[model samples]
Target: MSQDTQPAYRRILLKLSGEALLGEHHYGVDPAVLSQVAEEVCELSRRGVEVGIVIGGGNIFRGAGLAEGGVDRVTGDHMGMLATVINALALQDAIERAGRFCRVMSAIRINQVCEDYIRRRAVRHLEKGRVVVFAAGTGNPFFTTDSAASLRAIEINADLMIKATKVDGVYDADPFTQTDARRFDRLTYDDALERRLGVMDTTALVMCRDNELPIRVMNMFAKGDLQRLVMGESVGTLVEGSRQ
Candidate 1:
């Protein structure tokens, strides 16, 4: 596709796992991986696809993991949120270095470093062709970043939500362990929920369903996966509400 071509989804919310930034490392962000991700986003922006990104904190920290280690759940979650901010900053820097403008907006106030997320401001950024990165996971302790991605996508009027992960798509069982695992190319929101498929958290899935927002879960490590998805090529598991 031409770099000037219009994307299938005019605007999209990208959900990235913090662990994906780790690459082959045991933990934390890997510079090579982060740079590639930034390059992908930059390429999409160059193609006129308005993109908003939300990244998780699993690489640096996990609130649930800390809670299991005897830390306070709320405190652990707060730390996790801060971890996301760090990743957001790194990504913002990478995008900017790639000659694209990017804004880091945090749910929690970090005024000196980035702007506080305001719905109007974020929409305006997209209108002006600036990539917006959302951090801090809803600014609430209990919620996951997946829910934050859904909430922000709806607020920004995104055409679709994309969950970028290590796996290519959602399957009936864990593909790594289950040799016969079946991957679904398409699924009704209700069926995904009824089957207890972990496409995303139940809350995030419900939010998308209620809003009628479609989601594509695809593997980020796969070459050209994001580009293909934006160009309307089928490369991931699609989830949406069933129409009457």
Candidate 2:
């Protein structure tokens, strides 16, 4: 379908899981997952959707777990940051392989591998019609990538933030384990906060809510779900202040 035919946002931030990049593997990165993500992202670009991306490092390193085991928080955070950088490089290769121009910008200066993250430079790249992949988890410790996604969304003035998760949508309980869990077609930030929904981190949720930013949570594993989410169609769950 032509992009003009069905796109809800002129610009969006795609928050992808590192595990999604690993496909079905027990561990490590998977080429198939990378290719699949590239296909979907390229489809969005084809439909005229400007895309910015934030990648998670869970599949690579869950440093918080290490910190719990007695490692210094800063060291653990550095490991997580490096993991995100690896995901960023993989995403850059996949996006470019799909024939869409993309730039990988890291919070840390890895001049030989990718460009360093500079707000002005990132904006310029986007304005120039290039997809920008943001990595390295805010370049600090004790902060999750979810927060980074929110900060980048606001920094780049994104229309919406599409969180590509493992579930079809958000539920009152874990859908996988709970048989009676129901999915909401839409929700408000207040409700999410009041109920302590696990859909997003409290800090990230508060940032988006305060800014009146809309967030869509959808299953990346489901076929066409991510694309549909980007187009503002019924996909997974839509959490917002109101419908436009």
Candidate 3:
């Protein structure tokens, strides 16, 4: 492959918010959006990138949101974890239909539906060129999938962690509401944390910083964005332990 086509990283962990699955809908997964994400992932796999994914469950249920409504926090969080399993299964089917092998591994076991999450097995799946979708949010309450993504990325020894969002990159202010917001092309971990950029949850960001794992935030819905990013093109805001 030519320089432009060569992948920048051999392995990556992709974090996708559940809200991203709600394309043009009030709630629930949208088939079109799911297929689009699957196709993007398949493209990466074909290019020799070992892909691992951690998807959130905010679309179907949010533990934090329910806690404000008098729901027990632990119960709400467990429900949220199950919601992630639903998303994982949906994505797995889409990826298979897109012509790539996919596995859904849940932190909270549902034996008949998916494999239980085992770190070694997950890594082995990636080594064998299968896309592994990690679900169920660390199998615990009070922890967001963002934390799960960081944990899984570190466990898998991923070269990079990419957080796919609706916005193009991290900004000083909400880009949608503020036209004057400045989008950062790159940032240091300290800069992100100090400024409270909200790139990821504090736990997630700190974990990546301590481990020196680089993070890239970009828009999931942007055509060619994921491809460009993995291919070494500058397509999003990259956060690292220090300025590179």
Which run of 10 residues does model 1 get worst, by summed lDDT?
A: 1-10
Residue 208 shift from truth in candidate 3, angstroms: 0.2
As for candidate 2, its clashing pairs are: 3-47
Model 3 TM-score (2 dp): 0.98
The lDDT for every candidate, in the order shown, is 0.94, 0.86, 0.96
Model 2, poorest ten-residue lDDT window?
Answer: 1-10
lDDT of 3 by residue, 47-75 (tens): 99999999999999999999989999999
Error of 3 at 61 (Å): 0.3
- Candidate 3: residue 174 Cα off by (Å): 0.6
- Per-prediction TM-score to the true structure, in the order listed: 0.97, 0.95, 0.98
Residue 161, model 2, lDDT? 91
Q: What does candidate 1's lDDT look like per residue over 127-227, in tens digits?
A: 89999999999999989999999999999999999999889999999999999999999998898899999988999999999999999999998989999
Off by over 4 Å in 2: 2-6, 242-244
The superposed Cα distance between candidate 2 and the true structure at residue 241, in angstroms, equals 1.8
Candidate 1, residue 106: CA error in Å? 0.5
lDDT of 2 by residue, 1-244 (tens): 4456778788898888777777778777899888888888888887778889999898888779789999988999889889998988888888898999999888878889989999989988887778899999788887888889999998899999989988888899988898999988788988888898787888888899989788999888787877767666788887888544
